[model samples]
Target: MLDKHQAVQSHQKKSSRQKLAKVLLATLPMLTVLGATAGLSSCGFQLRGYDTPMLFDIAKTAVIIEDNRTAFPLKLPLTRRLEALGLDVIDNMTLADIANNSNNVGADPIAAITVNNIRFKRYELVGVLTEIRLVLSADVSYQTIENGKPVTLSNPIQVERSYQYNEASVSTDDQQGNQIRDWLYDTLARRITDQYVAISLPKVAPASANKSSQTLKSPEKTTVIVPSS
Candidate 1:
């Protein structure tokens, strides 16, 4: 009778081990998925937000407008965005001071000059003045005073924006146009910041820096008006 009871206890232990193995096998896939999700979260996977990081090198910057007629509308929005990036914005910087850094007395500051041109063209659809196409072209350049000499960090970076006309409601069309304008402003500002980050930032590790350097390129040139001192 004792031998029979010992055999029964051994069989029960084997049965318990088999049950636990089945349970672990069933949950293995879920555990793997959870682990992968946690790993991605730790590797900088994030939902996009408005407060994106600014990784530019310079601390203080001045925005100078060459054409007030076309670029004036964007001034306030650009200044606000630059300030949001924790930059020291100098409102009184002139275009002459940007091109030639002779007049800057104390610590030299970086300068950005924006020249804009806007045009509207009317389109006739089936013999009716149905749509208007508004085109805004902007050119932004950057200059910095390094060691008592002016250096052109970036040439004129051109950004163009346009949208189709909606003639259904006057107010709605106006609002849409304003929205597009705001989007263009934001896009231009982002492009400028990206360019600065690409050129100025020091090289990091081989893998990450190489990936970032691929999206960067040089800018072009444009004429700018000199503001009175």
Candidate 2:
């Protein structure tokens, strides 16, 4: 009886140790996974090519207008609208201001810019058993940043958008075409403006220590535009 009791006690101790070991082995992988997830969350990674504001945040700004490939001209429309959105509005800001191919020559810092879209569409009627209709289209490529270097937030340069006109809705073909073009122009302008301002946050400039930096020289400066009471 004494021998049996001793044997029983030893078996129970062995069983308990084994159970503990099993539990530890099961929990170790889960703990490791949790720790890895927490580490990534703390890092706060942002997606590549999400549009962030350039103005107010970045000191200098430049806009680049590519040559129009489409038959219809949208340059004037884009320029007027973008200027109203609060860009510096410099005419022919040198390529250096926009982007620098050579790092040594131009001192101008490159500015973040975006090209929204370019599109051309044509409607055609074809004979396939019964008059089949086909629409051929080409869309402008939109991109968030230029050059291989990442923008402040790695905003992408090009994204896809769709614009379509239905001749069935309008009485005149000219009216339909005009409406579609207007819609496309307006949409493209707003998209560029929204993305440009989205990532930028306001920053206050620190006061300069040098007296020369603080002062602006103006010999012929006169102001007389007070509202009359």
Candidate 3:
């Protein structure tokens, strides 16, 4: 009876895993297209010989944590990575500062990298040798300002990473945890930087009625017009 119960449990877990895998597979195509469009529109089609690597097509940018209550440490690493890619990092900007910077004359419109959510998950496997799995996931979006109005990217970046370790090693658990955190931070930052390369800056004038008073429209189903081979 115990053996039968264990087999049933194992089958249930396998079915759950398969279902999750299918969902991920279905979303992969959409995510791929969106990221490609982001890099091209934001970076102005580097494939055509443009030589700039800044993700937002803007002179200055700042990273903001949308929810400060979470105590997540992703902002600093992401900022450093963005700067390394040639973006002008404006430090010490508060959410209030970002809101108030709109529509000012000669003011460099500040683009923002906003992180919306962060989550951690853990799974423990029981066997002859027990194992543990850890996952870190974050949802992020970018906003570009044109003529002082904000246009947010429709497709947000979702980054996830998983790590596994032996459950018996209680002595090294703390060290392993720290290592996983750092690894997750690095991976998150790296993927964010990479995706930004495809984005293009909004046109400076932004086609307003008065030329100066016009607001930019945020794209919903942004598509890339790829050249035919």
**Collision count for each candidate, in order:** 0, 13, 12
Per-residue lDDT of 54-108 in model 1, one digit per residue for the tens? 3444566777765555566667766765555456677777776654554556645
The segments of candidate 2 whose C-alpha lies over 4 angstroms from its true place after superposition are: 1-55, 69-72, 91-97, 101-110, 114-117, 121-173, 202-229
Q: 1-229, model 3: which lDDT tens digit per residue? A: 9999999999999999999999999999999977875664454343332234324547677776655533257777887777655577776786578767865666777877766667767767777655556666667777775554577774444444444566566575557667877787778778776665545443333233333343244335778999999
**Any idea how many clashes model 3 has?**
12
Give the winner by TM-score: 3
Worst lDDT run of 10 residues, candidate 3, spans 202-211
Worst 10 residues of 1 by lDDT: 44-53
Q: Cα lDDT for residue 108, model 3? A: 71
Best by lDDT: 3
RMSD of each: 19.4, 24.6, 18.3
Backbone clash total for model 2 is 13
Cα error, candidate 3, residue 131 (Å): 2.8
Residue pairs in steric clash, candidate 1?
A: none
